[model samples]
Target chain A: MNHFIIKNRKDVQKLSTLAIFAGKTMLSNGAETYRVEDTINRICSSKENIKEVDSFVTQSGFFLTLEYEGEIFTYLKRVKDVGINLNKINLVNDFSRQFVNQDISLEKGMKTLDEINNIPGYPKYLKILGGSYVSGFFSLMYGGSPQDFLPSFIASFISLIILDKLSKFNLTFFIDRFIGAFLSSLLAIFAVKLGIGVNLDKIIIGSIMYLVPGVSITNSIRDTMSGDSLSGLSKGIEAILSALAIAFGVGIVLNLKSKGWI
Target chain B: MSVLLQFMYSFFATIGFAIYFGAPVNSIIPSGISGGASWSLYYIMFSILNDKILATFMGAFLVGTLGEALAIKYKKPATVFITPGIVPLVPGAGMYYTMSYLVGRNFNKAINAGTEVFFMAAAIAMGIIVSTIFTRTIRRFKRQN
Candidate 1:
């Protein structure tokens, strides 16, 4: 592949914008901070005559600067709606690698990125089925009897549907997780009372497993290990708060049960 | 028998989570393998050592190493595998119990569970870090040779 040449200030600006756009896509889709920084630097530096590129990425946003022909350009983007979509991250990762290795034009690159951004996640029914599988199997793993499986599945299925509907309201992640957990626990208790579930604790744990901050904990540790302490700290706090939210949701139900209120 | 059952359960559970997290379809089985293997390892270690934190550390390390290997083989980022693989080992039960004890006004048990939860999380982090360092050192050694 021929080397992409940097011809003018416009080219440099376009390159920087492309790099930032790629980074934003990755970051919003749950790539680690250091990986985003690396992708931005790699893409920016891929072209000839680009003298330098530096990128600073965090969990929330990123800043990138590029130098070409004694001129410096900077792009700062504040990313919102940070959701876990590993497919998008994978696509963007492949896109960046192709951009660096092949002589892809700036316009084509932007178009490809836009396409990646527009790709929808798995179908909603499949995701709900996945949710039920997770909760059902988790309860079994937690030592729930065979009878507990159906109840756990039913509880998580309803709660996941509710959570999916709740997403449209644009509520904070905390409230979303809190309500998910609360609803699941309430359903679990009802299932046990109805003799559908044999173990309340196991069912509750399984249902709430969907709300646990698994991605945040993994990403925070990874970011920290790779020396991105700022992103790591923030993500760690996010993990803790989300866990607390889940706990609070469950605890309320348990307290009510003990008080004979539910 | 129980261990095998746990393995199968975790495998499917992890696959479910992998799908929910939008992992690529081609990568789902590998992530499930990593998750199931790590959880079984944790179960065995926990049974032998009777220590939750240490067992979790062992589990996380296995997941990290396996994830890195799978990432290299599949040419995808390690997080794709590691994220789903580590979820089963996360101390969700600990978090729940701690809050339950606190709500019950049992400060002593709450502190106990809370401290264990904190250390288990730290152990998971340390395990992943150590595995990463180990993999990096191996790569460096290969490069030097």
Candidate 2:
């Protein structure tokens, strides 16, 4: 079901705003340039607060940014947690970036989650599931090169359609994220090897984007910068450990390829 | 054509990538413009020193100074523009290439690449730290006043 809690107004707004920026940043693959602009825009919009707001992403364990008044924060993560959701983030970021050139209202873009949540006739649980799926798929295809993007775009759409058919199984989000990334990466790699012109590096990194633990990476950097070495070290350690987990997961498939077991 | 336009285009492309990565909108364009102008220092330094690294440092210093001015002017964080502007200098692709070479067991190539990566990362880090310290000192001075 839609987990719509009426948090105290400030916190709720903060959470939603953070989610929007996090989602965007997540998609951009944590490139510094995009992040800088994103922070400036967010902070500029929130002129009244003039206080520090820290945002953490759960999946990536990365801190997006720490804003005190209007300044953005930055640092290198102690760990890397590459995964499929990172793909989803890129796709969404691409879509938004495309719209950046269009005349669409930013406020409307900002309200996408709420709009998805309040769709009529769909079961609340179904709506949430559907929204996540759509969002995931949209994000995966958004940031790719135009020509190569078509197939991944088509593949993502097809996967979501197929996923919807299998939704009755009620898998947890984490399980689905793993399965989705695994299958997508599998197809993406095959597509690249089979005479398609897609760049392997882009495919691997793009698909893994969906699952990278960005929040943790950002947090690790932030804690370190703020002189809380222990907190930073722990956060950095956690991020590094997660990166190993992701590398291992991808490594299994790569190993199979090496062993002629694929 | 004007030298300024070249810088503007480069700056725009840089900021465009930054926005794509998830920077707040307000910071991207302005930061980019400022980043390009920051290169002016390097242009001037090249004329005097004729040294690439020294020129690079001078340019970066100017960019950092400009970044501070923008932050104060916009009443936003210095990082919003500074991070993205300096991104062009980050050794990301170099680091990736070094790691790839090491993985492939090309020891000679890897070592060469690795050294470049180390230097680049260190320089970038130093630039950031220097600017940050500069800003902090200014802030402290203001408070003392």
lDDT scores of the candidates, listed in order: 0.91, 0.46
Tens-place lDDT digits, model 2, residues A1-262: 1222223445444544544553544422432223323443443234334345444433233344444435454422222333122223333444444333444333454565344323233233433333233223222222235344434433344444454566568664445544554555566567667756265444443344333333444434433554555555665565545544444444455545556666
User: What level of docking quality does candidate 1 show?
Assistant: medium
Reference A-B contact fraction recovered by candidate 2: 0.00
Model 2's lDDT to the true fold? 0.46
Candidate 1 off by > 4 Å: none
DockQ of candidate 2 compared with the true complex:
0.05
User: Candidate 1, after superposition: displacement of residue A195 in Å?
Assistant: 1.1
DockQ by candidate, in order? 0.79, 0.05
Over the stretch B1-145, how does candidate 2's per-residue lDDT look in tens digits? 3345436434643453344334455666787776566544444564578753565555556556667778688655455556446543433334434544554568899798667755544454455456656877898999999
Could you list the chain B TM-scores for each candidate? 0.98, 0.69
Model 2 misplaced regions, further than 4 Å:
A1-226, A231-262, B1-10, B35-64, B142-145
lDDT of 2 at A180: 54
* iRMS of each prediction: 1.0, 11.3
Among incorrect, acceptable, medium and high, the docking class of model 2 is: incorrect
